[model samples]
Target chain A: MSATPTPSPAHAPDAAPHADGTSALLHAEGLHKTYGSTPALAGADFSIRAGEVVAVMGPSGSGKSTLLHCLAGIVPPDSGRVLYRGRDLSALSDAQRSALRRGDFGFVFQFGQLVPELTCLENAALPVRLAGAGRKQAEAQARQWLERLEVDDIRHHRPGQVSGGQGQRVAVARALAARPSVVFADEPTGALDSLNGERVMQLLTEAARDSGAAVVLVTHEARVAAYSDREIVVRDGKARDMSAMAGVA
Target chain B: MSISHTLLGLLETGPRHGYDLKRAFDERFGHDRPLHYGQVYSTMSRLLKNGLVEVDGIEAGGGPERKRYAITDAGITDVEEWLATPEKPEPYLQSTLYTKLVLALLTDRDASSLLDTQRSEHLRLMRELTRRKTHGDLADQLICDHALFHLEADLRWLETAAARLDKLAKEVRR
Candidate 1:
């Protein structure tokens, strides 16, 4: 009754890199997470160097999002170590982790998540302001990012007033405005049409690269994943890196 | 990509020399694979023999004589028929990948890994096309989009096949 195919050289475990992730900006080892008897992540290992865009790809509920949360320190893994620049996330205090997330990390979700009451410029400047910068200085930084994302004209408009594409660009501007070292984007283009999606990805990746920010992109779409430098495919709570397997034919 | 038909259709716009025809085709349809001079001349000669085009005039150029071609009435009808006729859809029911998968399963090889490798290769090409599309002109975008869609369709099929691999392996083994 064994339906499993025999392992070949292409499937050799050695093809993947060691989980220690010595030089990675963000690294996770043997991560395990569960919620109410449902296992979200069994044992996933991941790593991303500075300025590298890595895609996390899997089917629905395949622990890709869980891996991202753990990597970003939003959700602590039950029994694993997530290290950011040699500092373990689990060892950090709540306030310290929050500071790290705000100061060193940026985020973009499927929905732009721009505050309805705030104008786009205000929304983009929120991160800079959170870091205790003055209002004028924060808005100036946000203004530069908005112009780079090509949504500066709509800076005064509220999130509800702009098109989906423009709103997403504004979201991107917000993410990059803070000058974070890493950007965690979960389905950043999922809500836009093809043309819009392409534009968003182009801007997001280009801005991230220009600023030397690593991107942990989580997506199920191959087209979206194409923007990444490489991909990690998560299935049944385990993660597999596909970059090493590129040599296979 | 019927070159003769395309050449004839281009001639419909107006009389054009062999050199002009090549430039037109390359500008419009030849983003990746431009028409060689030999190909253009050969296609034009074929069309002329078929009475779809006639030599309107000849220009004595510095290098050689350039014959200007104009589409005949029959050429217009041909172009019209080509435009109206729907191209046959490629089913690819017996694709090489399917054969390779079945063979891998029959030989007790790692079919799952094979699928993953293929998926990676497909995505690699897709990434290249996406990069080109990002920096290319409108025509380049359109052409890349067509390829990207087809590759996406193939990827979708690959995912489905991966999910059903065990069932397929069982069936094929039985």
Candidate 2:
């Protein structure tokens, strides 16, 4: 509340990004965002510890998406650095950032975001394939992740052929097939009903933590964040409160 | 990593039979990360039961065959969580030393000597850290980064602890 920051994570687990005590796997230091003078993140400082799952919640217009985008380096922060493994996003060239994003990060958006034309396994393996993995090897790893995510039953089904929740699970499995350093999601279950939403949440939470990747999800829902090892409430475009929950045993 | 953590850490190294984990852990940690043989078997049983570790299969033809422990996706998840769990720094336990504090009244040995001895050990540790870079298995940047932090923590704890003990010893002399 007094605005004194915690340590800059110079002595943390180095493996975790968030504040879950895995030691700042994803750290956004002094982040500020502006959309043509409409402020989004107001000098926000946030991090996702390694193996942590964080849910960001706020009212509409509260800049949840802005924070996610900024942290993910999808939207440039007007100020502040997004640090992954101690390297700042602002310092990387666009191409460099893209390659790191492709190799080291995974994303699940509000929509399923599945490429409709590809079958579930094909879509799930896209990132791996993009990384130049052979089609056979990529699909094989994708099948493993899909099974781990409990979506293996639909591996051959296209996005349009599956239920919305099922499609989103596929999206998550796809995002994680590369075992990225961090996984980012924007309103991951905003499209599904309660049961589906909860299922997706648990699956994402379990899958990400098991893989030791930091998962940051933006939502207005408290329950969604509860599944994470840490939760930070962003309000008025600034990180207002932060707390950590025990990691699931 | 604790005992279960030790087992999980071994799994991260790659698949191994149950006994292989025990031997590798002993080799990796030396006497410091000691384990009870029963504890290793217990951990293996639980991991298999919980679906975190799977028997990748058996290697036969050598007596009673052996089951290899590979981390299932769930096992890795468990290890990640274990790695990420909040660590309440363990209390600096040197029971014999704490005893020295309580029984220093009865000792005739010089107090400064103890301080000097401990400080040297700490300095040696810090010096070795400077000379050390993880060269082998823990070569990944992420894992190495974490190890560095832990080492730094050890160094800090040593310095602060040694300083505190020095002060305590000086006060006791007064």
Candidate 3:
């Protein structure tokens, strides 16, 4: 977690290379992200192992979100590459990229994006159904995830009915329902109080380790970053070596 | 370093049963600046409130009251940061201990008592460093050599001061 990734280490890293140049699960070299004329990321270089939790942090507009989006194939990077399990995401076709996004990555933003009108269980299971899973079985899997996350009691409640912490926990269970290899979460605990924030952070770190899914959590709070195994700080759209104190794991 | 800073460093080593931490601190650091029991427990409580360290469990009875403390990620972040930032060790030279020793010459207490303490400390440190240099390999080569030089300088200073005291003949006493 302390070492740098290899140069041009194959696409879709299954494990991150150490400082000595070993293999990693994901690697991005010379990664650059821009929006029209403004640069959101500048030739950023970062990587994560298959089951390692790496937190990315920075000041507002430092390009954390853009980097996450670029890595997940939700947005294309201006330059550089996003390699997942040996394939360059930028080189994949749109449908192939979509399939990867739907099947290989799980995302959770500050907003859980749960359908407000739907029951918590339905909201969590809907993604499974959309992924072509049978409804009953999908919900059963969803229920299991809910129970695992300690949100099973809220299965029939709406997002509005649960506490912020409980809602986010549900969101996490939903994201993990399909067992994606990676989970990109932005400010997962930003909306909660310190008590609840700590609870959520612990849950996230536990989830990543238990599921063997690498995590790229983004945040500005040092307390949140303390939960991560390692962290990379972004500044002026470039990934920089953060001294210590910065994201959520 | 201050007692509080040392306490924080001890807590940074992963969760330790409070009593065990106290013993480790005493064994490793307290010889120089002993951490009072009250101070150690107080610091533990403060660290817990600050979310840097946590109490994992409590022993059922008096078997040292398993007050295990662990360094949270935030705590690691803190120490990582401390290692990164430059430390100003020169200030320690002018700390209260040295200043008090220097001022002791103006009082009725025999300077021999203070000299005895300093001489004992210097010899002990020199012996420890010599043993380490001969057998234990330091992880950082340059830093270890630098530390050895610093200790050597302290020993030399102590020897010179002891000679100066012997030559004074009570002239500067009154």
Stretches of model 1 off by over 4 angstroms after superposition = A1-21, A247-249, B61-65
- In candidate 3, what are the lDDT values of residues A1-249, reduced to their tens digit? 112111112213255455437465667778887788998998677667877777786668889888888888888887788777667888899999887767677778787578899988998887678778998988987887787777888899999999988899888877777667888889988888866776676676676666677888898664465456666767678885332222211
Ranking by DockQ: 1, 3, 2
* Minimal lDDT window, size 10, model 3 chain B: B133-142
Off by over 4 Å in 3: A1-22, A241-249, B1-174
Per-chain TM-score of chain A in candidate 1 equals 0.90
Q: Can you tell me which runs of candidate 2 are displaced by over 4 Å?
A: A1-22, A244-249, B1-174
The lowest-lDDT stretch of 10 consecutive residues in candidate 2 chain A is A1-10
Restricted to chain B, the TM-score per model reads 0.93, 0.53, 0.52
Question: Among these predicted structures, which one has the highest lDDT?
Answer: 1
Return the top candidate by TM-score: 1
The number of clashing residue pairs in model 1 is 0
Q: Judged by lDDT against the true structure, how good is candidate 2?
A: 0.70
Which 10 consecutive residues of model 1 chain A have the lowest summed lDDT? Answer: A2-11
Best candidate per DockQ, number?
Answer: 1
Q: Local distance difference test, per candidate?
A: 0.86, 0.70, 0.69
